[model samples]
Target: MSKLAVGLMSGTSLDGIDAALVSIDEDKKMTLIDFETLPIDHEMKAKLKDAMDIGASSNELLCSLNFELGYLFSQAVKLVCEKSHTKLSQLDFIASHGQTIFHIPDGKFKSTMQLGEPAVIAYETGVPVVSNFRSMDMAAGGQGAPLVPYFDYVNYLSDETICLLNIGGISNVTIIPKNASIDDLVAFDTGPGNMIINGLMEAFYDLPYDKDGQIAALGQVNLELLEELLSDEYIHRSPPKSTGREKYGGFFVEDLIKKSKLPKEDLIATLTKFTALAIVCNIKAFGVSKIIANGGGVYNKTLMKYISESFDGQVEIGEYPDAKEAMAFALLGYETLHKRTSNVPSATGARKHVIQGSITYPS
Candidate 1:
């Protein structure tokens, strides 16, 4: 029998909360029942941005936001269930990725933090909650990121070289070559995704994002700036690595604006191209036969055009583009619920496979 569960993901892009109600069987097949992109109030958005900046945020603020986000997450949980006309009793569990505050995936101090207290969610909803999905892999000496590779491998592994790429606030790829084993997986972040472009949009025009490549379509890529941007060392890093808002957020955008001083349209165009090429740089050597892409970035036609023009492999968007990450988290939680180890050791640089997540019971 398939288990019914809800998965929630609030990515680095700060777009909104993605809630997915999905059904998963023991075989790892997922069917989305319903999904919603719940809006985060402007005040909450500003607070989330403040939380991302450790220097500007206080412990009190982080404390408040954690519980506040837990409340918001519970609301989202109810909304998803209600939207699908399914009761809370029908769900086996709630798995939330939570809003990532900061991710330090390197050095002896390697750690990652995500808010939305599981206790609060469980108590509020009267349902069990499983969260903090990255810590176990980190404890096992892994990067604690690019967790989606496990989801991709289970679903897309075959005798074909395929790349499952997700372009969220950051972009990462999972390359499963022909007849690959668990040790053969390759996955890592490809630097900025919608993060930089979204940052530029907000900085220059006070817009949340460039909807559907409209702004980029009107501008031309600045070759000089694009080349300069591509030289960043992260783009040169090997697989089993990951990056987050710290690398591409506020300061990075400010520096780019200062560096190129290009018009807003040109900046968007250049950044979009930068994202496309950075992804191409890493995946070209994999000899990938096809790329199945998801996340907010795939909707940008101009970005897609840039990537399609530069690559030789076939490119396709995922069927459940919007809900893919949410459903993936749901599946990850399902594994933990089963006491199964789901993190891909090769992809995450973990010493070994380990089950991840902290389970909390309702009050």
Candidate 2:
């Protein structure tokens, strides 16, 4: 049997919404039919960034933005369908990795929240919507993150030990051992990915990003600051761990600025180096023979060059490199509809395999 589905993702980068239309066959093969990224407008982006702040976050605001984001995701689906020349009636379901507002993996009350109400999406799209994909994993005593490793396992399993590195706002790596089984997989956040660098670019240069690493290439890295950054406690933490803006958001970038007297380009260069070094260090520890990289960070040529020079193994781009995360959610939604356990316990440190996501029917 073959089913057409749409996958929606709004990552930590807060850049845009990525929507992917895909076809899944009985054998569980995914063929991406069409994909598009809709840039988030400045006002909405500011509101979302504000909501991430504890002091600024309010019940009424968070409540409204949830539905607002739902509508935005709905629009993304409709646009992708229109672009693909598909109809809503022809779709199976929608898998939405809604905007993550907060993620506290370690605390007395451990929980994660992603808002973009599935009911709203369902109502708008007239299709079943699967949102809140991480809560179930957290309920099972897992980190409720790096959920794409299950998709990685399904698509990238091979005879060689390979690391799948995704560099969005935060970077995470999925380590699959040679001739891997579910139990042999390991994945965790490598540290700040494009988060710090993007923040710096926006603040200092008034640019959305350091396109093609042009800014960083012009300056020299402050190796001392890089060493200090690498010594952060999170960098040394063992697996089954994850982190987000709480640790690397605006405040972190501000502190970096206050600590350094370097020029803007030098600071960016240092931060870029820090990001690549952190990922390289983590991957090197696993001793993987091959590394497959994806996410928004892969587009940074300087960062990619730094990573390539640091690692001796072959570094390659992933399949469907641009839409990898979006496609993963689509696969996860497919698994959920089939009542299959989609979470990898080894990667998430869950007690056992469990079906993830909550489904909302249009009618």
Candidate 3:
């Protein structure tokens, strides 16, 4: 029998929710039936950004935002179903990658948190919901990130070295050897993806993002500044480690800006160059043969060209279609629902393959 699933993704960029309506056959093949990005309101966006940064959000605020995000996720799912002419009754389940508030991977907390009450989704949609996927991996001694590699293995693996690169708020790459399962994969955060560039654009240009990286393309790169940006110790860290805004975020960029005496345009340009260089340098370090790029970053022509040129013929972009992450997340959710083990133990450093996600049944 075929199963219909709704997958929700709110990336680290704080851009919006990507809703994908997917259908999977008994054979484990996936088809993306419909997809849309639901924009978050400006007020809520500000609140989320604030909370994402290090601060004490009132317990009331945290509780309220949790349910509110859950409701919004449900609304996105409903709109996707309505627009696609699919029925809630037809859905097998909803898989939600909720808004990640804090990813405390080491030191004190040793926990990662993504919040969108699956119970709320289940209550509203009358379908089972599976969510909070990362914590499970972390519990088993893994990075609890780059969760899409299992999906990449299932759908994009070929008889060659393939690097599935996701350029979300934080960039990460998954190296898949020919016919490799999760065991043979190597994955880690490459560096800043779209998040740093987007944050800079918003702070200086009053734009949500640099459209096609036009502003960046107009500026000149200061090679020295670019080198300084790339010298961070995180880039030298070994695999099995992941990063987010907490590391390359607003404050990090602000400090970079404060330390640099270059022109504003030049600064932006250098930062964009920094992002691209980080990817290229990591590719060299990771020994990835061909990189398949996706996410909002791929839409930026300048960024794409920089990466393409950096690697020369060593890598190519977009081996798969757009919406790859959403498609893969849908697959992840499906695997989770069936009680199948989904995480890549080597990529995440999990002790064993764990059937990830908490299931919430409809009332």
RMSD list, candidates in order:
1.0, 0.8, 1.5
Which pairs clash in the backbone of model 3?
142-348
> Can you write out model 2's per-residue Cα lDDT over 1-363, one digit (the tens) per residue?
898999999988999999999999998899999999988999999999889999788999899999999999999999999998999989989999999999999877679989888898899889999878998988998989889999999999998889999999999999999888988899999899999999999999888789999999998999898889999989888888899998999889889888889999999999999999899898787779898999989989999999998899999887777799999999999999999988888888889899999999997
**Residue range 193-262, candidate 3, lDDT tens digits:** 9888888888788888888989888989998877777888888777787889788888887887678787
TM-score of 3: 0.96
Q: What is the lDDT of residue 315 in candidate 1?
A: 93
Candidate 2 off by > 4 Å: none
Look at candidate 2 and tell me the lDDT of residue 158: 92
How close is every model to the real structure, measured as TM-score? 0.98, 0.99, 0.96
| lDDT of candidate model 2 versus the reference | 0.91
lDDT of 2 at 65: 97
Ranking by TM-score: 2, 1, 3
How would you order the candidates by lDDT, starting with the best?
A: 2, 1, 3
